[model samples]
Target: MDTRSLVQYELFGLWLLKRMALRFRCFAKDERCRGSSVIGLVCSWIETDLEGYRFGDNLIVGSMLDDLAPDTEDHQSRYTSSALDAVNAASIMLDFLKTRDVSLIKEIADLARDSVDMLAQEMISDDLTEAALENAIENHPLMVEELSLQEYLWSLAGEVAGSGDFFGDLIRANAEVEARLMK
Candidate 1:
């Protein structure tokens, strides 16, 4: 898979997991809500090969088995580590969401923003000023149409800094789904 597709997959997986976490929260509290349904949905989702479905407009061409299976079997081999990371993040986020009374979500979002900023700053380096970076990028053209790597990283940092509202996003998505179901 291409870098863009891989990113989309990771993002889509995160979004799906957040949606699932919300549903799981409902199941945990509401007696009427069937937890089995959620479990079954998760099972089906994970079991389905990457190529079995369409992610946005792009169609994945290979099975996730390609990722899960290692070329050489060893006691410690990295297979599906990326997917597992997403799953782990989702699980931890769900734990935070469960503590609705606390400010864990906000803290987590802030920490994420800070982490991204730090990483971006490290990638950008202090030696080059913003203007210098821009001048360099303008002078040197990449084959790709998009911004240079430094510019892209800087843009991402700016975006993360501007919108570090994880709790709001989750709430808004849930509210929209509820509103749609009512209709």
Candidate 2:
């Protein structure tokens, strides 16, 4: 697609994502692409879910077009068949990995080689709060103000560790003790 066309799509996607932010305030702070807003949103969803955070307790990756394409033919929208809907939704969820839709992101598994199991942990951490990410999303700034997603995750881990939540506090205390013992 031409640059102009891509920009148009991104703009439309931005509009849709921003509207989604009302429901999923977290989406308001995710990274975006100038060329494709839908892809941008999808990438953000994947990365956040991988970190264990989500908009809610329900399916972290729900219908991509629950609101976007309503009133359209049911086929292009959501399939009533739960299994097909899951398969179709999986395609959208994996679209980022398949197309490299966003640039500069290494696979989370690649970054989490040592602690890949964390991928299965429920999202009790929220270092990149909806407000903080919302700023980055709206301003198009890096969520960490840095490049390496790996470093950002660790830094975020520390923040989560210190967040006063029982789990987060325990993680933070453990890390500090480990640091002290190392020294």
Candidate 3:
């Protein structure tokens, strides 16, 4: 995949992680809520994640499509199939995450953060400017998965520097859901 597409996937994944974390925080604060409706929302979010993954995987597969010789139909098909499998896996993961409890959400968030860190390291080899590094470090709470849910989401998307608006939207959505559940 091209650098731009990779960046887009990374951004989308980050957004998804942020949203999932926010949802878990809201769920943790309320115990009275239960049953299928809430579960359904989570499931839908997972589906969205799967869709994002499909787009990512397709981009990866497309990169190899041009490398194969004109007659190499089998290889091309195999990559195409593999891309589909990745999408399916993403979908299943989404479904599983939706059904799981807050604890599982925490685990997933940790995994996602690790993945993001690894991806960043792989993608950005050059030393970041001092200011950039400082910004990342300062905003580490939101970007780091290990922090408390409230702190991470709030710091990541809350009025902190370098935070994307996506984080703020996630926080707002989470609050709205919680408010609905409380009523």
Lowest summed lDDT window (length 10), candidate 3: 63-72
Q: What overall lDDT, based on C-alpha atoms, would model 1 receive against the true structure?
A: 0.34
- Residue 83: error of model 3 in Å? 10
Reference-based TM-score, model 2: 0.19
List the global CA lDDT of all models: 0.34, 0.34, 0.38
Q: Can you write out model 2's per-residue Cα lDDT over 110-157, one digit (the tens) per residue?
A: 222212122112222446786764444434322222224334344444
Give the 10-residue window scoring lowest on summed lDDT in candidate 2.
Answer: 113-122
All candidates' TM-scores? 0.24, 0.19, 0.27
Model 2 bad stretches (over 4 Å)? 26-183
**Which pairs of residues collide in candidate 3?**
none
RMSD of each: 17.8, 18.7, 17.8
Deviation from native of the Cα of residue 113 in model 1, angstroms: 0.1
Q: List, residue by residue over 1-183, the lDDT tens digit for candidate 3.
A: 343333233323334444443433333334222222332333455445533433223333233322311232333232232222223223333434334333333444445454344334444435889678655644564344434543444343333223355446545645653453343
- Look at candidate 2 and give me any clashing residue pairs: 29-133, 29-134, 52-123
For candidate 2, the lDDT comes to: 0.34
